[model samples]
Target: MSDIPPLRPLLIERPEDEGAETPATVPPVPDLDIAVPPPRLSRARNSALTRFAMWVFGALFSFVLSVAAWDFVTSLLARDSLLGWIAMVLVGLAIVTAVALAAREMAGFARMGRIDSLRTNAIEAALKADVKAARGVVSGLGALYSARPELAEAQVRLTARGAEMFDADGILGLAEQELLGPLDQAARREVEAAARQVATVTALVPLALADVATALYSNLRMIRRIAAIYGGRSGTLGSLRLMRGVFAHLAATGALAVGDDMIHSVAGGSVLSRISRRFGEGVVNGALTARVGVAAIDVCRPLPFRTLPRPKTSNLVSRALAGLFADADRNEKVK
Candidate 1:
């Protein structure tokens, strides 16, 4: 090996040399920018520790409340048996109600899980071209929506023609066209409504952080409704899970931020940006909401977009903001 050279500073230090200048840091900017973020649930740096603390503290607090209740009931009993008995019964009922609510939450989670498994099974069957498994998936889908009067005709049609299809793709595709067609339309409507709401609020609301709160509320409600539309019937916790899943997918795919594609699609040529900056921010926010809604549909829908076409974020945003765009154009022309 040849002689090795040691690393050295670019300039030699000298006692008499003037003090070197420190590198300047970039100035901090506000998060509420014209190109906005659809609000995300923030996490602590030590997320695991935070979760542990939450559960431990929750359990201790609950236990303390329970002990206090029991003591109060016992003291009342010692004072007067009738009032104590009534209070005891009321407390017991409350406990039972809480247990029932908890059970309902668990059931909601299980329902969402069932839909997920159903989707997974459908994908597998479709890929393998397994007629039998596809039929099973169809049967499950039918059963899931059997209670709905609106699906009665679709259900009957599916059951009658399902036996005729010999391949998985055909079976699932037909099921898609029949069973999920109307449901898809309803879900699309929900997404549009959410996108419109988000865009309108973001553009008009001048208060700091107001847009963030509105976006969160609208997205959460939209997601929950979409889940219900797809037969997920998600409860509070289930809805939160769906929200996390939707946003996480967006983040993982790096689709969380607005891009050139979204900008062109939303405005048809950056027209919104020229019309009004705040309105432009609103438009971007609305587009992001549409993206989130589409992702929610993907997560909540039992079947993948193998047969049916998935909703495009562009198309949805364009239609959602058509009225707003027209209004903005009219105002621009008036000026």
Candidate 2:
């Protein structure tokens, strides 16, 4: 106190700092007055581009072929020369072939579209529990299930019952149980067999090319089998459409990833691994094929279960893998 002066609070405010405004702590404005728009219902548009391209190609090919045939026939009749005759014959043959091919493709597209529409209708009806709509669609699908007399009869009976039923759930459940249950069982068996075959091939075949060829052949066969089960017995064009639909469903539903993971897990290698042991690789391939088959069934089925739950993917994969490994063990024992 004696030696040093008592320090006063320093005046440190700069002129530039004077009157500086601070951000206000504003409370969030209540949004109670703002109305949220209802979510729009969007329709799934699967494979629209592919379908359009197919239609365009078919139309253009048919048009070009018709023009060529007309010109060739005109030349043949007007010129009466050997060259003209030969050209006419060749063009006629080509025209016939092209027309036939185009007709088949168009027919396939029509059939596939009809089936898809029918399926969509059935599912929506089932979900809504609309007994009348379900009955109508089921009855309309009689042509598809004609191959199975028992199933066809069941469909008729179910439709009649559905007409009288008040509960949509009961009607849908009954329809699925009586009509789709048998088909599902048969399809499952087919898929399991195919999976086993694929797995065995992957495990035993040393050559990558052979393995690929075998897998492709098995997958094609499996697709055909699943389509047949759904009463979609397709010709060449029909088969192609069915295969496309199956793949589209797999990709859309993320079943492709499940299949890939299963293959990797079972085979102990990636799906494209060339140096993997044939036996283990084959087993994995078979399991993957089986998953695809099951997914195809799900996609192709015309009915949905409102009361009954469908089998889960996990259950299917587990069963398929177990069956494959059990078969391997049995084979080893036999050896």
The candidate that wins on lDDT is 1
Worst 10 residues of 1 by lDDT: 31-40
lDDT for position 34 in model 1: 21
lDDT of 1 by residue, 1-335 (tens): 66888878799666863555445554544222121222222221468888899899999999999999999999999999998999999999999999988998888877777787788789789778888999999989988898989999998898889888788999999999998999999999999999999888888878999889999999999999998898988667767777887787676556567776666666657466567677878888898898898887877888888777888778899899988877877777788
Q: Per-residue error at 181 for model 1, in Å? A: 1.1
In model 1, what are the clashing residue pairs, if there are any?
A: none
Residues 260-295 of candidate 2: C-alpha lDDT, one tens digit per residue: 455454533432354335655565566568657866
Cα displacement (angstroms), candidate 2, residue 221, comes to: 2.8
Number of colliding residue pairs in each model: 0, 7
The top-ranked prediction according to TM-score is: 1
* TM-score of every model versus the real structure: 0.79, 0.65
Q: Candidate 2: lDDT of 39?
A: 15
